[model samples]
Target: MKRVINFWSLLGFISVSAFLATEIAVVAAAVVWGISSLFGLAMVPTIALGILVGVPSLYGMVKATILAFQAETDPENN
Candidate 1:
């Protein structure tokens, strides 16, 4: 039998994943900024570093979440 993935399930999964990614990025940015401030690091470099770290993780999470819902080509292969 072929595996099936419904639209709503995929949508809900992606939406929740995006929300989680956003929350993580925001928290990471705040923590990095705070730590940089404590150490007297410059604002521009701190923000840049935060974006460098957060954006890739966010992209990776979203990609992984979407891939998780993909239907298998051969259900029995699993």
Candidate 2:
């Protein structure tokens, strides 16, 4: 027996996964900013902190998701 991965399927899966992750991050950042506002944190510092934390976290998550998807789709896995 043999297995095959469809290129388009992988691409679409990765793209959609990344997109959903970005959307979640955006919402989370907004919530963090809003909470900081309630605590009277300076807007500039809050925005900077959000960018510093959010970017790398999002990147890591997306990278991990892609790797996992690839592993699952690998024909040799079977």
RMSD of each: 4.3, 3.8
- Cα misplacement distance, residue 17 of candidate 2 (Å): 1.9
TM-score of candidate 2 against the unseen true structure: 0.54
Overall lDDT per candidate, in order of appearance? 0.67, 0.72
Identify the leading candidate in terms of TM-score.
Answer: 1
Q: Native-vs-model 1 lDDT? A: 0.67
For residues 28-55, what per-residue lDDT tens digits would candidate 1 score against the true structure? 7787878888888787888787777778
Q: Residue-wise lDDT of candidate 2 within 1-78, one digit each (tens)?
A: 343567765776677677767776877678777878888878787887788777877786778677657665767763
Candidate 1's C-alpha runs over 4 A off are 59-78
| Candidate 2 ranges with C-alpha deviation above 4 Å | 1-3, 19-27, 76-78
Assess every candidate by TM-score: 0.56, 0.54
Number of clashes recorded per candidate: 0, 0
